[model samples]
Target: MRPGATRVGIIDYGMGNLYSVAKAVEHLGASAVVSDRAEVLAGTDRIIFPGVGAFGDCMAALEARELTDFVRVAAQTRPFLGICLGMQLLMESSEEHGAHAGLGLLPGRVLAFPPGAMRDRDGRPLKVPHMGWNELHQLVAHPLFAGIPQDAHFYFVHSFYVEPANPELLAAFADYGFPFCAAVAVDNLFALQCHPEKSGEAGLRLLGNFLAWDGGGGPACGI
Candidate 1:
């Protein structure tokens, strides 16, 4: 991390590919530090939560780290970003395995894909895990999509979608079985269901926009 560059704290709560996410942040000219310590967290300008696997496992890991409170603070006090399962965990709860509680940063629940509703072009049952490039239809405007073109295709890999109680928070949506929340934002907090690290240039640009965000949320906190 070079001096004066924006430092992004990539929370390492025992999930997801932190390395690749770090690389993507660095590629956007920001420093990505993976840490769970409250002390290290105070040193960054923004934070990112990237995770994979089950929601129950993620909640357990967060509880073990004793960093849950700090994460909630970061989400409200700074520009926060969540990716994939990380995004799902930002909601109030998830139905992945029985019932699992999330960070409650957003007013919604993560739900499994409606079984019979998931179908292919010819009406065959689509696979459980939706994997591949899908187009995101923009429903709201935000700094996260600053330079990214509308209706851009992003790589997605998930079987769950967020049902936000406040529909105004949804930034984009993609249709599989039905339209599902693909990205969400409320003030400074943001989450993306697509892997910006794998969506090629368009994804990279979204990261770059995040790196360059200079809203009134907070001052540049050093890298």
Candidate 2:
């Protein structure tokens, strides 16, 4: 690691797209230290909690690794970014497979896209998992959206979406059939339902903005 380099801890609870997230962080000129060890992660300047797979399984993995509490504390105290399933885990609970408690870092619940409620512009049914790229509408002027277009397309692949208890917590929204929470920003914490690593330039710009952010919910300092 170079001197003065920003060390970003990519929390590895064994259910995340660790390699992709690490590569994205390193591509932005930051040192990515992927670890589950609280001691090692605590030493980093920022945290990227990335995850894939079911909500319950991911939470169970965090618990199994004894990193649940560590994650809760780390997110509140630093520049934390949660991606996909990682974002869902920050909620109070989820109804993915069954009722399951979450990290409670944020007040919300992850709910599935109602099976027959979604319809396309043509009145055709939209599929679950909400796969493929979708346009993200910025609801709030957040630092994380720096340089990203107001309706930029980002890669999304999920069956459930977050519903924050406080409407003020919503940073962005996207439509599969109807508008859904795409991102949330509160203080030092920022999370996204879309995969930045797979979203190309706009995605990278978002990640870069995150790296330059000072956890103040203001404009990034510039990478």
lDDT of each: 0.85, 0.90
Model 2 Cα lDDT, one tens digit per residue, 1-223: 5568899999999989999998988898999999989999999999999999999998999999899988989888889999999999999999989999999988899999997779998999898879999999998888889899999999999999999998878889998888899998888888999999999999999999988988986433221
Each candidate's number of clashing pairs is 0, 0
Worst 10 residues of 2 by lDDT: 214-223
RMSD of 1: 3.9
RMSD of each: 3.9, 3.3
Candidate 1, 151-218: lDDT as tens digits? 89999999888898887777789989778999987777778999998899999988888888754332
Worst window of 10 by summed lDDT in candidate 1: 214-223
Q: How far does residue 39 in candidate 2 sit from its true spot (Å)?
A: 0.7
- Clashing pairs in model 1? none
User: Which candidate should be chosen as best, given lDDT against the real structure?
Assistant: 2
- State model 1's lDDT: 0.85
